[model samples]
Target chain A: MSLDFGLIIEQMPDILSGLWVTLWIWVVASILGAALGFLVAAARRYGPAPLDWLLKLYVEILRGNPFLIQLFLLYFGGPFIGLRLEPIPAGLIGLTIYASAYFSEIFRAGFQAVPRGHVEAAQCVGLSRSQILRRILLPEMTMLVLPQCVNMAIILIKETAILSIITVPEMTMVIGAIGSQQYAFVDAMFLLAIFYWVLVEICDWLGRRAEAKLSKFRFAVT
Target chain B: MSFKLFELMLWAAGYTVVLSAISIVIGLTIGLCVCAAKLARSRALSIPATVFISFFRGVPLLVQLLLIYNLLPAIGISVPSVVAAVIGLSLCTAAYQAENLRGGFNSVPKGLLEAADMVGLSPWQQLKRIRAPIALRLTLPALVNEAILILKASSLISVVGVIELTRMAQNLSASTYRPLLFYSVAGGLYLVICWTVAGGGALAERLTRTSRA
Candidate 1:
């Protein structure tokens, strides 16, 4: 109930450093996740019968388990298996894998959303498969993918808080350390919540802009 | 893993499922009310609902858990870790379920309500016959989705000292020095539980469809 803004201001440097860590994790997770997702999505879309089942199983396993457990498995289990990893790398790998599962679904849906007729039309016009994919499919899929990717970006930002449970020096952990040290429990938590809120709101705003652009794409197509 | 170890994991996962189910049920009830408020004509009723949904949705559940765990001491209400965990999960899930319910209800056509009104149906009858069923049906898939997410998220309750499945896995692995075995068991348990939930949801949907038909 008693919030001291001055206390928060005093702890600003620590909080800012925590924010920096969170930002880098978010960016790396997004890039790595998106890369893995595109690969999985492409394989799922184009690969033959047996590979479909294997790829689907990979996606299912990741989706079914919680991110925290995944992190524990990597952070703790990796060393046992000779793949020794630091906390930062373990956290990053865990998040990237988790994000890829969710992102792959989005990417798959984006691919599916592209109209089949357009691809057929491109083929009829003598465009090669890769050319058609680049020109027609990629453009249309980007319209759908951008907004969803933005959404996943927001989710990933919030999820980085979970990394703190594994001792990843993120904002949430920093806020906790500050809160208990200064007994500004309420103030520290309030600030932490606001930090996450602003991050998500920015992502949401960008998503809306992308969504608007998508509608314009559709408008132009029509 | 040994049989005893696997059994321990199963037992821990059972706790995970029970905690998640309790919270999900409570969240569904709370979500119904919040959804009702969000749909209400009165701004006074709707504004608080909006705030609740926004605050809960905007903040990550992990932070919420930590905050609530700490908040109880400040408020002179000392609850056990399990209680704190459930409260955190329930409130957080309620926010999401509320949004899901709102989305469901919003999909109910205005024309349908107008028709009900023209037929002189009372508010209660209209809600019972038209609004509730349509909304629940619309919300079925989302409800299932949220349930699975909460089940997975229940892992975070370990931070509050509930020692749920994931925490149990962490401890067992750290102690036994067989991280691979314990973590794999934990992952398998989660996957099993999730699929069961998903299968049940699919069954319920099918049953409803057949009964209607």
Candidate 2:
């Protein structure tokens, strides 16, 4: 089959719209997941024994299964429990939950990397818990966690493609729909790959820049 | 869920495990070659390996699967769904595994290699005794982590029509109107399989540590 730029040009508007949906999903899910994940990490670190066990189980089960299965369960299986949702909402929730499990682990590692003596020292100086968190923990973690969190952002961006499976009309879904109609499957597939690759490369660049800036700040502080 | 339906899911779960196992094995083999190429002195070898790792690692596996499934037909080499699935998974994992291997090898101490050289060890002997063993030990955990990632990723092969665990769950749920039941069962099956693999990896790590000591 001949390669066709004309077809992709014709579908540019649809492709752009699809890309927008992908960006929206990726941004919202990443932010929400990171926020929720930070709390989960903190709770697991300092929460009660039973609560820690429950969160551990939650994290393990989510991490173990595929995101596809989790999405299906939430979208298709939710109706059984009288919690039906539109495909996009279900996808957003599913992705947020999936991302939190991973993000929490990253945060947990960041927390662990900080020396316990620092927290103890802050406490001895009559620092409040929030003060210690702000003055001691957050600064120490800023550099360590930024890179992994950015990596997670890239992963979440890639995962937005999977939302197409549940009919979210993202870039992949648009490509699939147009390809079937135009019979330019190969070109469509390549175009889809380029879209994702560009997104990932941008994230990688941004992550590197942020890490550099943070490292400078870290050095300045010390 | 009915016993019959559960049995079908169990069979499908078996397929998932087998598919992931085969792909990981093939991927690891390809990974070694790519890793070697990446570590080679020549630009020609290293450049292509770098591009391969970047493309596979950057693109989502779903896109890769779709591209392979369709591109094969366009190139007049139409493959079955299972073949396409395996090819997609293997190539994708190979890239990640190559990076992991490169990291492991890079971590091998320069002093240790120099010591081997001083002992009159040939290059091949140094590779076999000093480099390979240290890299393997350093990378064992990452390898197991990749294996589990591949196992979870294998679920995406269902998109190409391979009736593995997730796809089987979908079909059963669609037919029986028991999405919750079947989906939960599928998730549980995946959890058990992943945990077992992880446990085995831990055990292997322990054995290797003792042997090394």
Best by DockQ: 2
**Per-residue alpha-carbon lDDT of model 1 for B1-213, expressed as tens digits?**
788988888899999999999999999999889988998999999999998997888789999898898888877899998999999999999999999999988888888889999999998999899888988998898999999999999999988889889889888987999888888889999999999999999998887762231
DockQ category of candidate 1: medium
Candidate 2, residues B1-213, lDDT tens digits: the string is 778889999999999999999999999999999999999999999999999998998999999999999889888997899999999999999999999999999988898999999999999999999899999898999999999999999999999999999999999999989999999999999999999999999999988862332
Interface DockQ of each model: 0.72, 0.86
TM-score for candidate 2, please give it. Answer: 0.97
Give each candidate's interface RMSD in Å.
1.2, 0.7
**Candidate 2 per-residue C-alpha lDDT over A113-211 given as tens digits, one digit per residue, 9 for 90 to 100:** 888888999999999999998989998987789999999999888888899999998899998899889988889889889878888988899899989
Off by over 4 Å in 2: A124-126, A216-222, B210-213
The local lDDT score (0 to 100) that residue B137 gets in candidate 2 is 92
Give the clash count for each candidate: 0, 0
